[model samples]
Target chain A: MVVEVRLFASFREGRFKEKELELPEGSSLGDLLAQLEIAQKDAKITIVNGSAVSAEHKLSDHDVIAIFPPIAGG
Target chain B: MAGYAGTFLRINLSTGQIDKESLDLELAAKFIGGRGLASYFLTQEVDPDVEPLDPANKLIVATGPLTGSRAPTGGRYMVVTKSPLSGTIASSNSGGFWGAELKRAGYDFIIIEGKSDKPCYIHINDDTVEIRDAGKYWGKLVGETTDLLLEDTGDPKARVLTIGPAGEKLSLLAAIMNDKYRAAGRSGVGAVMGSKNLKAIVARGTGKLKPAREDECKSVVKNALKKIRENDVTSKGLPTYGTSVLVNVINESGIYPTNNFQESYFPTADKTSGETLAEKYLVRNVACFACPIACGRYSKVGEVEGEGPEYETIWSYGASCGVDDLEAIIKANNWCNEYGLDTISAGATIACAMELCQKGLVDPDEIDGPALEFGSGEAIVEWTRKMGESEGFGAKLALGSARLAEQYGAPELSMSVKKLELPAYDVRGIQGHGLQSATSNRGGCHVRGYLIAPEIIGLPEKLDPLSLEGKAVWVKIFQDLTAVIDSLGLCLFTSFALGADDYRDMFNAIAGQDLTTESLLQAGDRIWNLERMFNLNAGVGPEQDKLPRRLLAEPISSGPCKGHVHRLPELLPEYYKERGWDEKGLPTEEKLAQLEIA
Candidate 1:
């Protein structure tokens, strides 16, 4: 399965803005995060398919994954 | 020798007497100035049982060592008093020229006491302080009052802090407005000032602040500012969009708190978002004195052109009330600024009444012929004006959400803590925020321990917003850190870019003192406990550290966190344990002894 990932803020500054990620069917969110070239320690990932999702959660096909550097605005 | 004015001006409004007293270094060493110092004064001087609006109440306007310095975002002050709304210690911090001017005027703080026999204003120029008659400006709006004071003082650079009709009427949600728009806008501190018959305070200063080590201080500030500029949020996001960026993000997260929190999110969030405001209404960017980031937005929506609403105010009056009109939000923001009202409390109270009207809990006749329904932008604006002047239906709404709901016999519907209304965040989705709001010293406030840094924004570290584990320790640390920053007159946004080490360096450079992160954090803890002690002595205790039934019992009906409720029970015990407090929420004597407090 393939999923489109979008990055924002500092994450967008690093390299790719959006990418098509090829992953196995029924891959967990952690597996997808590990596949990206981006450092997991640097990026704060949230799956924004209507709601914020955790990394350990499962991802479905076409799930809009939005990743960004840690936000600190009040 | 540096970082402080070394003195404070004491004014007895009743006697029209002004005196200058040397700053107490021992107190400064313990409290570290600003809100901390104000808390010390409030606890030491004001009796716990005295009514907030009574003559016995003291209003302490304080500035910190970092205020007016070159430190990043250090231009802020705190107005501390017993809140008429909550009857607890209320310290509302504001960013503007007033705090910087106060420091330049050769004072670290101004302690005001005793009710005046008539309207008066305090004029402070350098070392000279006087109580002047304010009869001409008594009934004016905050803007008009500030303009008149500036004109009267004949100094265009003079900074003025004043109250409006809302304050004059002793509204529980009245605010002290400065720089025409910036406000210490919560907990009814303005009502306390009005009760003392203080109309305005105009300050003019010609002195310069000298840090103990000018070269080192300048270097520290430069480095901190550079780091702040490098940060994405402080440098780009906030400067470009102000705080309105949170609207879309929180809305997307399904924690926008729409319609008095009955709904988790607003469908029309885009219409009331920061991006829309910046694209549509933004005219220019403004900054407080000595501030580099310029996060303040000046906007023009129709005829209104001034300071636009931040994310909280936009959410409070826009999505929370079910009003999605951007122009209406701008107009309401202007009105609140002019009227010197806390927009969050004002909007929350109105939303509560509107909900009551919808459920037939409140009669339409009582609302003065307007159907107080959700999304009524017209009614919101109209009633805000009324509330500002304490007229018609506005009179009732000025009492604040908890009081308004209690009056209608549906206090459970009010989303508030200690009578002060909640801000933009919905606790059902943000459980740490729920605990923070419930345990905030003032009331339902986000600033006290903004756990959103870790939970929502993922700053420093990522934590699950839905999880209850380890939040107690984080909340305690954040609370202590916030207390230090707030007391030091530094903007909390600086924490996004800089840590306690940077703050300690700045402190050492400015104050000529050797300080460590641990020591500074201890100061924050001391201030926090002192505030809690004040509230505890003021009759607010474990019973008050509770959410409304709506938040505690009713799960969010729809959206991402649908059927989810705040897990306060799961978290409160841990929070208590971390704070060294008893199950009843009382700070134990052992903890006090450890902190060296008698």
Candidate 2:
């Protein structure tokens, strides 16, 4: 299976803005975070496709995951 | 008296009479200060039905109790008047050195009544106030006006507040620019100033402000500084990238309005995100007086240097116009600052025009400049200049989106509420924010409540954005609390790290008043109800408390939040109830009595 990952704000430092990575099916969001070397605590806002989800949520083929640090401005 | 300057200035421009009057302490206690107190005076002094640009209209500039104090982000002020755009009570807020200087000048506020016989500007020193001829500075842009005023005053350190050609020509989209780049940037406040034939206000002061309970105030301020330093949003994100950082986060949520809100998602949004801004054109981070967060961005596009292209500005010029050209957006932002136009209204009006042209309502021969088309960087830039200058076809654009769309026979195309253009968020996906926008006292505004903190950023706690459950209650509380923050002369961003209790402590220590959290919020409630009453009396009643038709009827075409329309129908009634208003959205007599406003 393949998943697209999006990073924003400070979370993108020394990392990619967005990219697709090959992963085994049934990988939990936590497992993907670990694979990307991002801490669970640092992923303050996690979105699967377009809905906010928890790290324990499972990922599937072609799922788009977006992770942001604790950030806000308006 | 401890928190405020104890004195205010009443300048009758029509008679050239400058009167120094004592601030009404009892009224300040009830309304807090700045926005709240100013609105109180406006309602009492001016008729609600008066034409907004008539000599009968009053423009009040006021500072909060905390303004120029030791409090964090305390350099704030409010420009309160009836909005020519929304026909609602307008209290546009801004931060910079000008507000703090006004505090030090021993005046809590200034009320400019009647129209001036000729163009003039006010110059204020500690004990000297004069209205001088501004014949040489009449048609200059904001930046040039500020420079010439400072030179004329012969005080290099004095701060200048002025409107540009947009206001001089009475474009409804004009803004009041201060300290070169800062603005009270909504609701056509500048037009009111221009109608008075007022050119600028220059202030230089050396006085100091002292809190009522010096020791307690110091301790509370210390604690607030610590919390602000620890908060990630304040300490890291905003300081690093400014407010533009929200570009990607909001876009990723799929609620970012695109192309006059005909769409909700823009795939190329990253090109205009904060990350791109920092990497491309950032010159430096700027801070207001006594500010620790420093969310202001100073950027340069080639030879031109200016401030901002903030999150809302980026959305208005970039995604809402379907133009992903970041440099073009920056240039347009510069035009707005120079010409004294509200970027959101100017850009959204252009987007509405683009859609009108696309639908054949706007004839090609009618356009005197560049083609009105989405994704045309040239159109966004040139049209903005034209709007500010009120030139040719740009004159139509200066009327703002609601009027422009209505003139073309498609009022539904204007993405506005109560005639004020909506900001960046496509509220269809964010239910609570939608309710807030629909009922905002000054029309489609986000700062009145800022439900985005809890719904999108998960500040205090995250709530499901799409859920309608308990959203009415959330919107009511947020709106009330926000009124308190605005009145106190503090930036709304402080709410991210602080709570009601924190504000209560600060206010008590400064104002020598013991207000419990409940009582403090009641004051906010009082201010909100007063604004509502003014609007109702002005004929903007319950019927105006509605979202645009598209927001209620059309579901987002495609996005992560596709197939969702703002559930305002379910939220409005609940919100009215929570606000202690009757079914028709009028404040109940008993409720007004409880708030001591009756």
Pick the DockQ winner. Answer: 2
Give lDDT tens digits, candidate 1, residues B1-598.
6898899988999888788999977669678899998899889999988999889899999999999888878889999999999988999999989999999999999999999999999999887888999999999988888888999899999999999989999999999999999999999999999999999999888889988999999899889988988887777778877888677667767788998899987988878877678778999988887777788889997677889688888988898899999888888888899999999999888889888888899876777835778898887788889999999878888889888888889988788999889888888888888888888999889999998777778777767788888888888899999998999998888888888899999988998878888999988888889999999889898788888787878898987778888888888889999999998778899988877676
- Residue B46 error for model 1, in Å? 0.6
What is the lDDT of every predicted structure here?
0.86, 0.93
What RMSD, rounded to one decimal, does every model reach?
3.1, 0.8
DockQ for every model comes to 0.32, 0.86
Model 1 pairs in collision:
none
lDDT of 2: 0.93
lDDT of the structure predicted as candidate 1? 0.86
lDDT at position A30, candidate 2? 97
